[model samples]
Target chain A: MISNRLFIRLLAFAALVAVIAAIFWSQNPAFLSGGNIRALMRHMSVQGLAALGLTFVIVVRHFDLSFPGVASMGAMTLGWLIASGAPFPAAIAGALAVGLVFGLVNGIAVARFGLPDIVTTIATGGLAVGFSYFYSNGTSISQNFFMSGILDLNDKRIIGLDMPFAILMAAAGVAAVVLHASRVGAGMYATGQNRVSARFAGIATRRLIVLAFALCGTMACLAITLLVASSGAANVTAGGQLLMPAFAAVYLGAALFGRPSVGATLAGTLMMSTMLNGFTLLAIPYYYSDAIVSTVLIAAIAIFDPRLSGLLNFRKAAA
Target chain B: MSALTADIPQRRRGADFLMRYAFFILVAVVFVAFAILRPTFVTPGNIHGMLMSASIAGLMFLGLTWLIAAGEIDVSFMSVAALANMVTAALVQDGQGWALASLGGLGAGVAFGLVNASLVAGLRLPALVITIATGALAASIAAAIGLGTSIALNNTGFVGQVLGLRVGVLPLIAVIVAGLYAVSWFVQERLTFGHYIYAMEQNRAAVVEAGVPVNRMLFMLFVLSGVVSSLAGVLLAANLSSGQPYLGTSYFLDGLTAVLLGGMALKLGKPNVLGTLAATIFLIGLLNGAALLGWTDSQRQIVRGSLLLVGVGLVVFARSRRKT
Candidate 1:
């Protein structure tokens, strides 16, 4: 007999397909045109990278509301460096470094200091925004990085596909390989599914938690690079607005892959990004697009075997 | 001194309460400091304006404390508030009765809450994830319904008449907000339902195992939240005399800040009503004082961030000491 899990998942995928089709049917049936498809891919890539990083931290059962903040900081640092006559590669490296340091701090606080996840991340996100604001002097950075030839990563396309998409896919591939094929992945999963059990199994639970955060931070850095490349400017609010969408993608993606895996999260990101793209193409009002996406997320999770949510209910009900 | 050390536990509880609530006190300190420094923050109009802006956010915080204390978070409360405002506006524009419109808005909010409860309690989704989804979805629906057209209540209609009536020294909206806090406090302290929620928060599984219908209780709380938020929303619409689609996002930050500042840590699983109320007022005072003092928006954000960090830091330290 087919498991309820399989049935629900199939139903979810079907719902996703239907939404995609409905969006295309309403707006531009030709949204499937090659050019539009490529553009959508690039859009998905930016969000997908951030979601991939978020998956690692979340799967370990920790919240990182600071991704957008960190990503924005990275983007601003990169853009600022590039504008200030820094070399192209150095600007990118500096951006990634900012993310790395922030991630380390987050990991240490969560692991060593035992700060609650959401509260800490929220506070850190504020700090990141503050740093970004100070760096940008409370204004949008409008100096064109593209104009200076400091960043060509966004402009370079391979086989009609944007370079950012390629870069994101490469990052996703590495995450997938490390998570699925390596022992570190197993440790991470063990820690997430059951920390006590993982500890009993001799896994260094705190180390795993820190590592997950670091990976997430690195992923966010990658996403910021793409976003800055696409927009060619950075501001304090550049990634602030992305917090909700990123949350949506992470949670909604978890509903799909049964956990936050690199592959499943990528699927969730594509589902959301393309749905938004398709809605815009079809001339669906912004409000309607929000409604449709929200419906899809809730329906996707709820319709999936009641058992999946049942476990969570048991804890909530019991507590 | 030796005797004092022996009484440390008793003394510390009082101290912890005081320190945990220092953010609220800090608000007064900030106000006084700003007044001394700039001499403008003490003006009556600026104080009233700050209180008024905070009352809108404060109304939602009172309800949210119960939900958060019960170990269920409804981030979509703000979305519900915005939707309630939008519906009220749309109704008034369409020539609907004011009373009838308010009822409809509350009903819609409760329905949204039910949806959230069903997903979180029935289907077992994490409150964080479900609330995030619902919050986004609710905002979208609100935006979709409003259709990018903000309805201003300035026209000679039922909403206009209701909104136009401001009580002397306090808007009707402000009065309604005070009423909400009173009701929320009563529900939190005087009711057995509040006790059950605290029990549920401490150990939801234990509460469920004791043969209580945890799902139903939690679901009801969410519905109650919807009602509270909707009431706030309708009042906000009347006060503002218009409904903006994205207006609810500010409430999200403000409500969360109020809850945390109020010293009700989610980890503690107990809702401190008075503490939260005090914190709400304090935050409003700080922001209002800052604005009056000619602090830039960025400077205000920095101060807000610093206050939040300090507040949470103190609470964490106090809680850890108590536990140990």
Candidate 2:
């Protein structure tokens, strides 16, 4: 279903990546080293999962701005449980439980109460972040972090792939099946495209929306759990830094595929992470990556949509 | 009269009264409650500080409320404020006068507004995401200009002193903001442009059919918000005596909360100047009281966040009830 214009845009994106990569490669030959490549892949894992979760939410025409806050909540809840000498498995369950509860709260608020997603999620996100801070007393929790062997998940390999990427791919696999191959997936797409029509056509649009948010929240926690395992610490704000990048990746994916998709989101995440890694290789200032991401997001929005033939001709085309 | 006849109208009257004045009641209750709890809260110094904050916050609210009233949004005001902060401070550091420097800052705000208007109104993209991108870009550009740090300003300029000056119990900035609101109130309550803007929100197609310049109105609202937010940025810079790239996210949260809180009162789920003024007072009082009461950061945030959720929820609830 992807058009020729999308195809050209994808090629143009590839060329842009290559050109940027070539510039970084010239500055530092180590930019293309195996170590860097592996590191970039590792970096992509959490963001990949974030984008994957977001794809489903976007497919249902809902925005979940609360994921980072939910991630923070999950990671901190796990940290709190583990610190109190709870069983490792139980702590993981507790963290996942936090995600599900918050997800459901967000879902009910938006889908059931008919609240606007933007402000409602911001409120939920604030509550999540607040709870996280209250747990850690606004500091990083690391007292029992070392004793918990969950850090092994970061180092261990599964099926010859790094543990994080393996986990990411597995989640992506499930998401792909559910979003593309299942009957519910069809309902979600239709609901997003035209909610009134979908409702008239006998789809449980509200239920599907709540489900998307619930899945999104749970998957965000799963990704953040890996981050905590990899880093051996949980803080109040680490997950927040991922929100904008996750959004950019989702937009890039939508722009590429002409619709939100799990696979395209994964690809978008990988592309963004690679460019970010390249920026790091070039020793650019840290915040510059955000500048690049923001610029790319704007460019993608302006140029990629097939509705507008050119930038300045927007009114004419829209008319 | 029978109990049923009297009680029914009384109950209905009670709700109607609440629907009209709940915001003012809330403001009065919060003010009195805080005054009773914290003796220091009612002091002139603290009151001055609160009013000063409310003034700058009021500017932010004015900008956001205009867009929101028109059924558009600008979440990037914080970023634009940061850019204006940097531009003003950087120009000052380059030995430029304050007037010129402030103009440079406001120009930055205008630039962001124009970009936002073009992307949103002209290209028909979603305002939320477009502004998010532009906000990030503005903040980053501000960071680049400041080398990812704060540039210090002395706050010695006459305008800064005037802004900081106190007229009895009132801060001068509060007077400025109130004057600006008075002007906005005129435009909103008396102007055909204002009616067109609101009509566009309620029914864009009908407005287009009527042959009003809806796109032009949208552009004007965007630019108007941009300029107002930039003004807030300059005022904030004056208060802080510095230009900072690394501003906290609280301003954005606070602005949204105040504006949305205002959505519940005066105009019944619509953004209005009077509702926002009362809401801003309540919001500023809450934060000020929280500080004086020694609440933790998390505690304050939790309360504020809940208020936002509840406020927006009430607005939705009111709308649905009206519909039914």
Candidate 3:
């Protein structure tokens, strides 16, 4: 159920996006081209899917810093499997399986053993990346990847949307259902808001925490795996660059909605991807994108924080 | 609950005692096994080399010890270090004296830390996100100034000589690090502020009720982290004879591992200077031994990651067992 306030804000955001799009289009006629739109979707889905996954962990008040590691491992697994004569579907499953295992370990460690979320994820992620490094010894795994049908699948369109976007939509649909319209979702939200009270209410907060993390890690990997298929080579360092942008998207969503929600995350992902896309189309130096991400991230979080809200009320977050 | 804990099975008590000493046992076993398997590993030259490599990360870990003890985290300091590193290198390249360059770098790090403290401690924002934001800013600034490349120091010979000052076969940096740890130990074990920081970590409400200044304590911890990290950057520059805009990040995993591994040792769930010091040695030894055994970089990293989890798991299990 969308609140009236959120609905109005969404409309206003759409207007802002439209204005930005017009400005970009005025600068470059190819800004709204079909191929460019597809390319943008492909790029956005990577951060989009990862940010969607991150929403769960953040809502539960936990962080999984291991996404980059796990995601790289997933991509590496796909590349490694394909290079070793494995069938494409089997290779995809292999990558997802690796993601699931890592996610499960992360959740179990945090929920069962009571480890800190940050360091545990960092350790596990590092372990995953270390393992990923072994397949090619720090080189990109490119053998047989081009000959595989992955590129076809990666670019294939389903209902006018690319494969990556299609996957993103399916995942987002599932997230929207599970996070908003389900009993377990409510329990998860309650757990995030107050763990002790959720436990007293018989919510099985630990199990929900585990579930949130498992889903988070798996989706993070899925996003990166699809992205690697698009890029055609899997390097151990490929996922490192995704952290700031994806994090910005998730936090931006949470700030927009007063808390993390599925739709807001998707919207935030769209905004971030488009902004980066615009930057690419413009004559801006590529290095400035990192600065832009940092600014947006700080601004997004700063606005919602009570200490800065008074300063922000006349500006963005008054809505 | 107290009465129930008064009696325990002898077998369980033995297990508990072993659990408490497991870190030392592991360290000893690894060291002795390495020495026996490779006699050359115990040579003074190799030990000195290890000590030399350990000091930079050791310095950062010491600062992190304070932050972690206060229940705060800084993902930004390394990036801040990178900023400091590049600033020093850039200034040195501009024909600045060593003192001026060092000050320029340390100033950048200090400013970054104070900003982090204000947002995290004053505004009560989440530390991770704020630090990450600041970290990104620092890295960006470093890259912008350094043109996204590394800068070599101007007076390499002189810088090396200064940082490499030795007294009676002991590198002055190592001595300084040890002295710094002694100061940390003094503050942690003997000072009221140290006790207050720990108490704040354990229970913020109780500390507030007692009218302790929480924000000031947080500022001190973060500033300490930033200052030490900045110094680590300078030492790192001397070690490498060059500084990259993103170089300090290479030490992040090493720093965190040492700090967390330390938490599982002497203090057993509490991050402390002695634990960081010992764990730093243990970590450097593990890496050194792996290299001596012809292990690949991947293999060393894999082992290090696994040990990190195991160490944290032991800390968790120890806490649970003690509570029960």
DockQ of each: 0.53, 0.70, 0.66
lDDT minimum window of 10 residues, candidate 1 chain B: B263-272
Estimate, for each residue in A74-151, the C-alpha lDDT of model 1 and write its tens digit: 878887887787877888888888887878778888887777677667767767776786676766675757566645
TM-score of each: 0.89, 0.94, 0.93
lDDT of model number 1? 0.75
Clashing pairs in 2: none
lDDT of 3 at B136: 87
Give candidate 3's error at residue B105 in angstroms: 0.6
Question: lDDT values of the candidates?
Answer: 0.75, 0.82, 0.83
Q: Quality of candidate 2's docking, in CAPRI categories?
A: medium
Clashing residue pairs in candidate 3 (N, C-alpha, C atoms within 3 angstroms): none
Better of 1 and 3 by DockQ: 3
Which candidate has the highest DockQ of all? 2
Candidate 2 residue runs with Cα over 4 Å from true position: A1-13, A309-319, B1-13
Model 3's number of clashes is: 0
